[model samples]
Target chain A: MNETALKELLYKIADDQLILGHRNSEWTGFGPLLEEDIAFSSMAQDKVGQSHALYQMLQTLGEKDPDTVAFMRNADQFHNCILVELPNGEYDFSLIRHFLYDTAEAIRFEMLSESSYQPLADISKKIRAELRYHTLHANTWVKQLGSATEESISRLQRSLDSAMPYALGMFEESPFEKDLISSKIFGGEQALKERWIKKIEAVISQTQLRLPDWKALQPVTGGRTGKHSEYLQPLLDEMSEVFKIDPTAEW
Target chain B: MPTREQVYTWLEEVKDPEIPVLSLVDLGVITDVQIINNEVLIEMTPTFVGCPALDFMKQEIHETLNRHGIDRVTIDVTFRKAWNSDLITEKGKAALKKFGLAPPPSRELFTELDVLEHATCPRCNGTNTELRNTFGPTLCRSIHYCNTCREAFEQFKPL
Candidate 1:
């Protein structure tokens, strides 16, 4: 197994979870309903914890400690796709993004559960069960809001259309895609993307929401290679705000 | 030498940091305790992967044993095996009820649609209940309202 390929895979996975987890947590006090608030908060905690675990694995592979790596890094050093770094716009947009992003994430973890890397496979197996509930939550809400009222249907449709491009960016392949695939560390982003399309389509088909043409939506790429939206730097600053105050202080 | 039973009893005194009424042992978070070379090694698991209480719980566990004259201790937090509400002891269930939180059902069936739908009201033990929301203030809880007692309560949701 190629060490560089393995590290690249871990960095992107860990970064995606951390950034999106922060976004989900922002909905804590502001959810349209208290239930949604709690649900997003739960997912936020899970993602953050998952990222911490991955970061710990990275530390064993000769990287900086999880705290320093997570808190001290500039936005360009992050490998998360742009889809996760986007602001949570309206309830419709957030829900649509959650549905799109988590659908792919669930499949990605599911594929990695069988990876040849024992540590990655072990963690993925544990994470896969948790992701099951996330996808379930997304699918249920999408079906409910998608078909309910004309206003809700329209709102969700608009968000879905807007999010489609960035969601495609989530599958922007890592430069080591072939090495990851051949090394049996991952199945590569293209395979995961193909499955994500089918899974998202399955859920969307149950509702009034329409799936847009994939060929038409130009993918918002560059997050993998470290070019991020303006939104990311602000998010990183906010997340590390307290940590930067006193890195040595034990909280 | 401290016996395994003695360790278990000591752990029973360590209440869950979130829910003070229930001990960590009663909550089923403490899976095994072993005595090796007079050092206590604890094997424990979190109720949820992202459970924020996990670190505090570990600290409490260490302090509880340490204050009891066991200085050398090691705690291993493992996620290879998941936790379910069925792990909650009978005492823990009663404690939750007395604390105004409905205990989760012990069954393994956890379909997302019906996970929180059937919780009996903790206050009045009412059978007629409606699920207000599947999410609550904490990861282990959900909100439900009782038609019989006309009250809303939290249920320790089945995992």
Candidate 2:
């Protein structure tokens, strides 16, 4: 693939992490439960770290520095998973997003951990370490809330019901999935999606909630294609406001 | 290259911000220390990510080197590879055992997260323990409860 296309694709992945991480960080102190709070916070930190590594990879192409890539891009240029761009709903909604997104993330990282690209594999290792905790956290909630207080169960199912559509966006393809696979930059994306669905199905079955027929969801041209929900603009506004104060200032 | 005497002298002054008996170098947390161009570049990994003492340690590293008028020092934390208890030195292992948290039979003998890898009662060696919760006073450790010892102790969770 050409350098421009590669950088763009890498930026999509980096920006997705950056934006999703920003959204997750917003709940740092506010999570409903303390352990979950720390868990969420830790996941957010790891995502930022992963973004840094991806930006470093992007730098190999001699384009925007990590900060500029993080701060300068407008919403139209971003290609993160659509699921990450959605607004945080109720606590259950956040957990739903966490469960769905993180489950996919775990498989994604698992594949990347073995990527032919050394730096990417190395980072995938670091990311997967923290993601294990995140996966556990989300799974625990899926089990607990799926079988917890009436309110908790209801909220969880409702969130899962609504978010299920957007969740499909997580697997939406990028322009480089084929080359990324061929180059062994990371394994085939479909293998990741397959594991993601299977793993989530197994876990969700352990709860009181009925798994949404996986067949019901259809892919949407969300963030993967540079389109995003209304939430992205506001999220980008808050995250970049600090860096934009003096974009050139070393952070 | 640091002479053994110089390295020992440096290690003596650096203490873990959480557990003072432990020195950063002694903990084997400092993997490689190379002094070049009158500047020291130190590579170390934290016991866990989000380790609060790390920021303090970085500051301590800078101050320690500055005290020697070593113009500059860079303390780099690598997370490419996870830091395992095996990374701790024998003396560091002894310190843990003496402190009542028995060191693993030996680093090599311990499988990746051998059941023994979890927190042993720093008060009494107990295999049957319960994690009261995951978070602790610090991010690097977890608060675990030993039913046998009837004590609450901090266990350093593997990163």
Candidate 3:
């Protein structure tokens, strides 16, 4: 297997979880309902925890420790998709993004569970089980809000339209797409994207939300290659502020 | 040198931090115990990868062994065997019920919401319950409300 390809794959997936987990934590005190608050916070914990596990795997493959890899990096070094780094925006937008992003993630992990990389396969089996709850939560809300009222339907529809491009960016092909697929480290981005589209469409069809034409939408690419938006650096700065204050501080 | 059985017996003193009634041995996180040349090696897995109680549990295991005069303790936490709710021993389930949390049901597959949405009420032992939230105060629990008991309770979620 190509070590570079494997590390690239691991870095992007781990970065996505870490950034989105931080976004989910932002909802802790601000969720529209008590359950939503706990839901996002719980999911945040799971995501961050899952990312740490992935980073540990990377360490075994010769990367830095989880904390250093997560906190010490600049924005340009990150490999998360732009969709996760975007601000939570509003309840409707956050819900929409959650619906979209987790839909893909659930399927991604399911595929990775069968990965030829034994360690990844082992962890993915555990992660895939936990992600079932996340997708369930997201799906329930999306179905409800998508058909609830004119205002809710409109809000979710607008967010869905606006988020489509970035959501598509989630499948931005890594330079090692060929290597990852050939080595069976991953099933490949395009394959995952196809499965993702079908899954999201099935869920959205149950509600009033309309997915944008797949071919018509332009993907906001480059995040996979460490090309992120202006939003990423600030988010990273805030996330790592405490860690930077005392690098050796023990909790 | 302490035998593996003796080490396991000593570890029975260490309880899960969150659920005091249950010991780590009964909780089934302790996957293996090995002793070689006066050194003790213990392998364990977490109920949840992000479970906050994991480190505390590890510390408790070390302290418990240390107290037993087995000072050379090495603990390895891994996903090699990967823990599921089914791993909880029968004794552990009773402990969880006694502790006022519904024990997770034995499950073959967990792809649906049905298993989570329904749980027997620990207070009333009634099946008439409604899921309030799939997530609870902790990662391993889900909140449910029982019509019979008319109380909100947490279930050690089936994963």
How do these models rank on TM-score, best leading?
3, 1, 2
- Tens-place lDDT digits, model 3, residues A46-126: 999999999999999999999999999999899999999999999999999998999999999999999999999988999
Tell how far residue B108 is off in model 3, in angstroms: 2.2
Candidate 1: regions farther than 4 A off: B124-126
- lDDT string, candidate 3, B100-146, tens digits: 99999876756688877768999989889999999999999999999
Return the top candidate by lDDT. 3
iRMS, model 3 (angstroms): 0.5
Instruction: Tell me the tens digit of each residue's lDDT in model 2 across A1-251.
Output: 44554565567767767877887888888988776677667667767766876886788778767788787788888889778888776688988898888888878878877877666677666666656656766886689879988888888888888888888777777677777777777666578778888898898888888768878767666687778878888888888898888877753
DockQ, every prediction: 0.48, 0.29, 0.86
Candidate 1 structure quality by residue, lDDT tens digits, A1-251: 89889998999999999999999999989999878988998889889989998998899899999999999999999999999999999889999999999999989999999899888887787687678778878988999999999999999999999999999999998888899999899999999999999998898999998999988889999999899999999999999999999999887
TM-score, chain B only, every model? 0.94, 0.72, 0.96
The top-ranked prediction according to DockQ is: 3
Candidate 3 docking classification: high
Worst 10-residue lDDT window for candidate 2 chain A reads: A1-10
Per TM-score, the best of the predicted structures is 3
Pick the winner on lDDT between candidates 1 and 2: 1
Ranking, lDDT, top scorer first? 3, 1, 2
